[model samples]
Target: MKHPAFFKQFLITICLTFFLAPNLEAQTKRIKRPKSSVGISSVDNYVRNSFDLYDKVYKYDGYAAAGTPLDDDDIDVLEDALDDLALISESAPDILSSLDGQNAFKKAKATLQINKANKALKYSVKTAKELLAGEREREKDDDDSSESNENSDEESDKNINNDNSNDDGEEEPSNVSDGLEVYSKYDFVPGDKILFFDDFSQDFVGDLPSKWNTNGSGAIVKLNKVEGNWFELKAGYRLYVIPDINELPEDYTIEFDVLTSGLSNQTSSGARLHIVLSDTNAFSNGKTHYAAVTLPLGQYAAFNINAYNHFNGKGGMINSGLTADIRDEVKNQPHIAISVTKKRYRLWVNEVKYVDIPRFIEELDVLNYLKFHLYGLKDGEERVFIKNIKVAEGGVDLRRKLLREGKISTNGILFDSGSANIQPQSLGIVRQISQVLMQDESIKLNIIGHTDSDGSDEANLKLSKDRAAAVKEALVNIYNISADRLTTDGKGETQPVGDNGTTDGKALNRRVEFVKTQR
Candidate 1:
């Protein structure tokens, strides 16, 4: 049965709120809420609407207060009520921002109303979320289908494909999970051959991405903080966004970067960013054979990140609700890495390996496509964006290649656009190679850099030389390799491995080569 657009948004909203709002009763009891504003009727309505629900919550006891689960019909009613609240959350800022105080009374009213709205939003959001979480425990227990049971908790992904934001890079950096040195054990590696790569640079802002298909709505956006373009993901129940990458070999890796906002302890949790591996490219979740890895975004620190998987049409279970708590790291823009090697599956958030399971992926060849499914998040309130998605064939063992062939050329080393500055994540490749130099004191290397044919030949030539010099610098300063042991060279775009006309081709053309020589 096809659901109206309204119902689809409810899918993840309730689930996220289920976890985000931990204590509703205490949350709703604001010590001293001020009076409503004089000129803003909408503000008054928001307060009244939230208060009505608040009254019922305290009156008959909340979903947990009275010690009983709400009926299925009641759950539907609450969902409908949440829809109205979401609209109020989006529109309230506009209404409140427009309020001007021409006089003392007017200014006082503005201040009072702002306080009222903030408290009401917090209380009401908590009430709805906690009720959803506390009430639906039984429902979750009874539910067997993979649909509702997905381990998802994200701030609404409603901004990826939308270009309507006033964000400049001035906002403080998101709370990044610290101590990356602990994640040195991150073992997943990308494939050597590029299959699909997109940074959204080819797409225009405020337009839907050209190479992606979605049953829901999203658009391309450029932000002041992050470099390049990103796709804003809209939220809906069971809504799937399928990328243009069509074929996936049995051994391949998927990597992407994610950014989020409007997540806090006061907000509700409602969606999971579902990275799915399917047998078919259709809109459905591939009923016959599929594997999905769930990512919970935008939750409070009290909750641990959960990894839930649906394998071979619900016939098996490897793990669910693992204690991989990345709530802090996730909100701070983490580089996500996933590798599928034959039948094994592994995932890492930033530098930490969070999940690894043998036999988790049942059929390696049947998983041919990749897609994303997300549930409810209020439009304009919560947001998630993604960029730099690379799907490549399984990588060769570079260490082995270096020892055997005396040289290794790789595209895994990345740099900032239009510059030779190496991205922090790209240091992993360098770190691995540095180990090889340490193990064999007699080995020395000539570092060579190459680029695609996008700029002037002179500029490209100089940029490649600078890049190779940068690699040599990293070997000396960061990895402690002797500077005398390395030589630097640049071929620029003269030596091309793939076509420059296409994304993958261009990605392959930009390479860094390490050639071993006598010390």
Candidate 2:
């Protein structure tokens, strides 16, 4: 019935801790939102509110980076602020980008601060969430110390039904180390042009994503056992949650990560996570046609691919047919990749291609939008989550572009913000580039890295150079490309291919170019 109002009267932010149940049970309270003068755009009021959260995140990073934990009360308030910021980002992601390249002098000064804050936000959020989860667990122990073991065992039993995991009463580890070398044979090249990308970082922990429409219902959720925000889909027959992608071009690639939770030995074999590509973006399967790729959860279950109401082609695991643990992927989190080039369709779960049909689609330009269908699962008892849904266009050959044009610039090669660490998935573009060098011994390249106008000019330049070196290292070590045949450089934020104000524009500006060297 009582609360202390810190920092006089400027109470600005708080996250609803309702979702932190079974672990943390903190009461919702206002946090001190520091005043910020970072005017990102015309919306001064909006920018101030976001920068306030950014300031909090900046301080949290200091606490976490120094290996220091926050007091319980302070940590709770910070968690609330993060939740609030996530909701704001869901609606207006542009607001999250403080530097819009509006005024040259002002933009340059603000970008340095904004970029550092952006990088810190991620580290601080993870540390704070982990602390909150610890607090929640401690509270649970205090509430009922006697029943702790019993409750944990019961929770583990609800994990997975694939039968690969014995009822050992241990939860799966959160951090997964799925390496890249396994994907050496994986040739699913992503589109050169970005279409739609949603890690659900913009959405609040318990709200529906801003870029999706569903006939049934689903919520964006954060797991204590795992990191990142995931969309937990509710199941029903013919129910679909569709992303707000405008249309699918003739050639494009789609990639997303899937993880399963709350399954047991009694789980039904019929439960499956269905991915549908349809002509219309609405709640219905196309009247004329729709293509589907189905991933089954149960062991000895068939994974299916079909062109709705036309034909179905499938590959499955039956008794005595498969040897690998089906439960490993579902629990450990698996990456799914789909590449559609006109009539030809190819789908891969991790590195393995489940479907590759030359004439998978009857028509080339029929499929336009994306739909997700979850079939035959108890909503509360069994749960499935999907994150990092990326749909991009133009997976065309790059060898010709190098020879005919003497240069290749691609947005497909990706890295973390202001970091040299390249994403494992982005290697597909690099793989193609390496082929050109392999085919002809005389070929040499200058790998140049670029970045969006986020951080300071100096920091961005160093980051870009480091990223270029990382790509070159990958080529020499992984693809066996010679180090002597390659040179590296970074353009930083100097070259602007797209407007820094919008999301798509920023994605375009952050690219890697390979230029053929004149010997």
Candidate 3:
């Protein structure tokens, strides 16, 4: 029996009561606080009040300054200041609040200065420690050098005393006072007068006069004056040789005696007493052939036959091809004997047969016209002695016996289609070619490239050029073959090995050929 206005007012009252009831219960649930005798209890109350004020200032200032980007250093400083201010507010909030804003900022600046000073002191101490360590290392190096010098001086004194003692009595055959004994087996050919001592002594110095020159270090040829049967050829050098020869022997044997004063750890390139016989005219025109026995002091000796035409400004055979490590017992006082015939090359060191390259002479025509020269190599100022130089001849014809072995196939592989890229599978064939070249230094080659008729003549021509270039690159880059020694040409479809009618024939048509440019 209520009016409409009364009903609406009653509904509004019920909704309001429902919302307000939860909040009122929450308030009633709070624990009652005890009465404090010291005002606001401890620092917890002060910290809360200060935080409220800090939030207002930070919000208004936008973290100290409006629109300023905070770098890492700046952020660190602000964080540290906030932590300190929080601690102060907790313990002494009333005093902190009583201070002026300027005074608070001054306190923060003082704290930052102290931190910077501490960091600087740490760096200064580190720098001082490094300087001390450097001085200590330098002192250690000086001590080591002094010790080494003293050892060297002591050794030199010992050597001098020994020499002085030997000088009084009958001197033992010192390396510098002895002459080497030379002998030969071959009878001289008709119209041939062998010169025994042709500039063998050190008659000329500096760069080896005329045909004689050196390839490596310590290359000298000198004459030594001696008493009694000791006539010494003082060779104070590392590697010395006569590059050019005017005449060469068809059959001969050369023997010599060598005495080395000292031996080095470095391998001698090809040090020996050499009788180099070559056609001097042939050498000037780049067509030279020669054979010699290389006596590596303190090491094993070997006989070699070389027939290659070296152009001007090009390094000769001794510099590039010779490999002899003469730093052993045999290097001190060794007797070397080399005998050459039409077919065989033999070498003996101290009555021991060291090299027997059978039919080596037949491999190349080394003895046409002949010249004789003496060469020695010393890596430094070390001295060497040569005695007993002789030449004669009587040897086997091993070349005639090994003629069949010379006919071994030197054929190589061919390229594919219109591409210049060499297939990985072709490596075997390329390696065979490399082996042939390496075995015979005198051999010059013409590498020819060809193509099948599948492509146009012009395209095939270009393809052929690319294929030749690719092969050359493989040999020179991958195999370490000398670029100067290689000659490449492309014939395109002009030269075919087989018919172009079928797949097999087309494959055969695309091939490369290796032709010997020299005998």
List runs of model 2 lying over 4 Å from the truth.
1-177, 225-227, 299-326, 416-418
> What is the alpha-carbon lDDT for the whole of candidate 2?
0.65
Residues 1-519, model 3: lDDT tens digits:
224464344334433443443322110111111111111112223323333333332332232122233334433343444444445434552433433433323333222322222222222233222221221112234335535644554454334324422222322222221111111111211111232222233333433333333443323344332211212333433223433433445565555555555454443534444444443333222244444444444333332322222323343433222344334324435545566665565565543455566654433454543323223445344456444344433232322222324422111232322356453323444555555666666765667777878769998888777777777777776566787777888888997766676443455566666666645
Q: What ranking emerges by TM-score with the best candidate at the front?
A: 1, 2, 3
- Model 1 TM-score relative to the real fold: 0.64
Compare the candidates by TM-score and give the number of the best one.
1
List the candidate 1 regions with Cα displacement exceeding 4 Å: 1-186
Tens-digit lDDT string for candidate 2 (192-284): 888988878768888999899998899999886566789998889879999998688989999888878876556677777778877787786
- What's the residue-level lDDT of 211 in candidate 1? 83
In the predicted model 2, the residue pairs found to clash are 15-80, 23-136, 24-136
Model 3, which residues run further than 4 Å from truth? 1-195, 198-249, 259-262, 266-277, 281-288, 291-326, 363-379, 382-387, 393-519
lDDT of each: 0.67, 0.65, 0.41
Please give each candidate's TM-score. Answer: 0.64, 0.61, 0.29
The per-residue C-alpha lDDT of model 3 at residue 511 equals 68
User: CA shift at 105, candidate 3, in angstroms?
Assistant: 99
